[model samples]
Target: MNRVLRAALFALVVAYLIAPLLVVAGVSLNERQVLFFPPQGLSLRWYGAAFTDPSWYRPAINSLLVATFAALIAVSIALPLSYVVWRYRVRYAKAVMAMGLAPFALPPVITALGALALWIVLQSYGRPYTVVLSHGAFLTTLPLATLTVGLQNLNPQLVEAARTMGATGSAVFRTIVFPFVRPYLIAGFVFAFVLSLNEYIIAYMTVGFTFETLPVKIFASLRYGYSPVMAAISVLFFAFAVVVFAAVGRLGDLPRLLGADETD
Candidate 1:
């Protein structure tokens, strides 16, 4: 009886979570230009427009570029930070890591405001690269966390053995540390990339006028009127996230990468 009740509760929770997405999916299939659920008629024209139309396509390309570079920057910062904290055990490393995590810890609106002020002070507001850099800085915590977990799970004996065999610092990392942490590194990149792809406020604040990402563009379109294309884009993004996470799980020991301990 207890197991049956638990299963029923789980199904209810899943349905509650998925209900909104299902509504959006239905709206995206509407034949009319206006947003309406339980469509007047069913069609996929909005999805086609999202791909072929320059307005939609361009912002999507911009989002892809920003997300790619932002993920790279995040991983670059996290890799060294995690390595230094783990290997050297520097006294200030924890403080530095905390600083790295501050952006994510704070409300996103706060981070967006800060990024806005930063670009304005530098007189670099509206530049295309500003969004990428701001996003990279804000999203650093994800990769930092994943990499830290990977390093914690690493066996110190391996590093000691490599050093005793006369391996240089670079050699030791390349042969031992990096291999152990590579999965975590990839997971971290994926986390940062997907979040960056969907991020809105920072992109809008940093480069709203000059460079538009997909999310920014979607909001920009709202002033004119609601379009089913926005719904279509939302569904497409949801699909993308689902596919990326599924791939990560399929290709890796996802639970272990995410810090789950090995179970016999």
Candidate 2:
């Protein structure tokens, strides 16, 4: 593409992705209680409300708690799983990985229904922890995929050298394997964290009328009336997500993380 054409295309794509967020942020500053594009007047009232109101605070806390626990669980499970798949390459490795990622592949509504049924069978209703578990189930796949790519790029010679130096299996892994994969692990953790934070459908279905997360709270507010507070929350969430991904990009090779050929 020519320089001008390429620049125009890129700008269009950026606007397409950013327009909704910009609108939400703009509406959040409106002095009016109701949501409107091209906000009637500018004020920080909604942002203040989100910060001070218990109604918003509680759900925000819930979201943070769930996202933190889910990210931890996802990383814990994915580390070993990725290692096994990369090192052993067992006969059913692909099948096992696919099954682990099944929740993400199916329609989200189907996953929500399945989780609800499973929760009912397990008799764990009205539990916020169940929502965390469900989020972990889906988010683990992203970390696993990221770690797998990192492992694939790793040179086996490093491990073999450690072994030749009389290093034990665990020692070799700690000294060599772990360091090489650290960047990927960080990337995976951030990915899982963000996914768990923003996820809504599963949280909505599985929690039912019991517990509420940030997204659920925002969604409920929208039903009653649009408020600038929702926009404030959106702005916060967007800022957080951007910071996380930017940190990941800085820590690791962004192009490689996105499946580009780093060799070129």
Candidate 3:
């Protein structure tokens, strides 16, 4: 009876969480321009528009580019920071790690505002690259945390053996450390990429009207009034998120990457 009750509660919770997305998906199927539920009739035209329409397509491409570059930048920053802290136990490592995480710890608006100010001061505001930099800095924490976890799970004996075999520091890292943590690296990159793709505040604040990510574009489209295209885009994004996460789960121990124990 207890197990049945728990299952029932779980189903209810899932339904509550997914209800809005289901509604959006249903609305995306509407043939009319108006946002309507039960969708007057089934149509995939909006989906086609989401991909082919310049307004949606261009911003989406920009978002992908920014996300890719931002994820790379985040991983570049996190890999060394995590490695030094884990491998060398550097002094003030915790403080340094905290700093890496500070951007994410603060409110997004605060970070966005700060990025805006900095860019303006440097007279670099409204540049396309500014959003990329802002997102990379803001999303560094994901990779930092994931890499740290991977480093923690690494066997010290493996390093020692490599060193005993006359492996140089770079060689050890290249051959062993990297391979061991590669999955975590990929996980971190994906985490940052997905978040960056969906991010609006920092991108908007940094580039304003000069650059538009998909999230920024979606919000911008709202000013013109409602359209089924937005709903179609939402469904596309949802499908994308599902596919990416599913791939990540298959490629890595998703639970452990999320801080679950090996035993769990």
Winning candidate number (lDDT): 1
lDDT tens per residue, model 1, 195-234: 9999999999999947889999998888767888888999
Q: Tell me the whole-model lDDT of each prediction, alpha carbons only.
A: 0.92, 0.86, 0.91
lDDT per residue (tens digit) for residues 112-215 in model 2: 88889989899996698899998888788888888988998889988888888899978978988899888888888888888888888999988855889889
If both were scored by TM-score, which would come out higher, candidate 1 or candidate 2? 1
- Assess candidate 2 and give its TM-score to the true structure: 0.95
Q: lDDT score, residue 143, model 1?
A: 95
Runs off by more than 4 Å, candidate 2: none
TM-scores, all candidates, are 0.96, 0.95, 0.96
Higher-lDDT candidate among 1 and 3? 1
Error at 25, model 1, angstroms: 0.8
Clashes of each: 0, 0, 0
Using lDDT as the measure, what is the rank order of every candidate, best first?
1, 3, 2
Kindly provide the TM-score of model 1 when superposed on the true structure, using C-alpha atoms.
0.96
